[model samples]
Target: SMGNQILGGGGFGTRLMSEVREKRGLSYGVYSGFTPMQARGPFMINLQTRAEMSEGTLKLVQDVLADYLKTGPTEKELDDAKRELSGSFPLSTASNADIVGQLGAIGFYNLPLSHLEDFMQQSQNLTVEQVRAALNKHLSTDKMVIVSAGPTVPQKPLPAPTDKPAEQPLGV
Candidate 1:
């Protein structure tokens, strides 16, 4: 999740481009994204790199995350983000299906009807300090789970098997 917060195609893409791809040549592309549900949902970072560079790529991801957390978005960037968010919200309610889905979300999540009503206002009200604080608090490199799927073997051996007996014998 921390990887996602730091590597996804959203605001964090710039860091991935600079640190991992350009500086280290670790990946062809790297991106991070977040989908906040009723509570904090998954933040995901994805990348494409040569199999040999996987470990180094992962390390670079961590380094990039550390840098990003310490230095959040600039004031102009924050203003642009708020503007984009506010501008795009109307499109989220454009179609009947969209409206129904939003309403369903509100009901499912027990959100008040005023939630949608207040969205734009709330987004407008968000301060740069708030965003920076949120980034510092939530996007920590120390609290992360890394999952890699590739041809390269892991540096460490796999964990020992559980002692519980199998339901059916192997090769049955």
Candidate 2:
């Protein structure tokens, strides 16, 4: 479930920026990312655009999510994602802070020291179908909460289908 949400949410953001901003000239430099924590976290869309484009940009993000849920990533897209992730993994681990943080995480989670070593191999083995399956299980745009802070924030109506779905009733 977490995997599904991450991929879908990331893909949705990428699709939104490319289609709504770059192609249609609605915004400049739109991006999205998700943080799936041990319990719950946040998915955010960051965009830079004029005040006039805010509503349209929001609509575009919603549309992107809907479309992504209906049709997940293709094999090529999935492969590209894996390649990018694998390629970037080394760079991310290059920092001392990264190493310490990872070590700390292993300790916190009671994972074996070998967890770090196995990470890359595991990531490489992830297939597109696996990522898509994860995305399908995790991403629920309806459960997402929206928050914004800035002058000239648009008064656009929030995307329809407004009822917030109950979270998976977190259990101890």
Candidate 3:
């Protein structure tokens, strides 16, 4: 879910991007992350829009978060998130720098030596219910902390797009 917020499915495109940007014209970007920790770490979601749209964008963000928390994730969403992680995982291990970082975390945190292996194994086996449950348990909107800085503007409806799509591009 966090990954979807950040990079979308496999980073090809994202739901949040679609909802907040493409559909609603709210913000340029929004992102989230889930990092390993000895106990619990952070799950963050963030975005930015025009000064006038900040409040509306924030509301939309809260709405999105509320929907996510309430319903958890659909099976397709769950599968997509897992696929994205697994497909890109090789990059996380593709370099000595990456290996060193992985090892450093394991050592620094006193994590099991098989942490990497265990992580892959566990991730592959997680069900949609499990992912949804885990995220709901930890990533609650009730517990979220929001801080915003922007100019205040009277709320207004998004300007309807009046331009029609071109039949073909100039080059094409």
Candidate with top lDDT is: 3
Which of the two, 2 or 3, has more TM-score? Answer: 3
- The clash count of every prediction, one per candidate, is 8, 6, 0
Ranking by TM-score: 3, 1, 2
Show the lowest summed lDDT stretch of 10 residues, model 1: 163-172
Q: Write the per-residue lDDT of candidate 3 for residues 1-172, one digit (tens) a residue.
A: 3334333333225656656666555555576666667788876666777766667667777777677667766777766667777887778889999999989988989989999888867877777667667767887777888888767777665534222323211211
lDDT of 1 at 70: 71
> What lDDT tens digits, residue by residue, belong to model 2 across residues 1-172?
2233233334433566556544455554566666646665666666655565566666777777767666776666656666666777788669899888888878876788898788777876776666666666766778877665556754543222212223211110
Local distance difference test, each candidate: 0.64, 0.60, 0.65
**lDDT, model 1:** 0.64
C-alpha RMSD (angstroms) for model 2: 10.7
Top TM-score hit: 3
Worst 10 residues of 3 by lDDT: 163-172
Model 1 lDDT tens row, 35-89: 6687777767888766665776677678767766777666665666666666777
Query: Which one wins by lDDT: 2 or 3?
Result: 3
Reference-based lDDT, residue 63, model 2: 77
**Which residue ranges in model 2 land beyond 4 Å of their true spot?**
1-13, 149-172
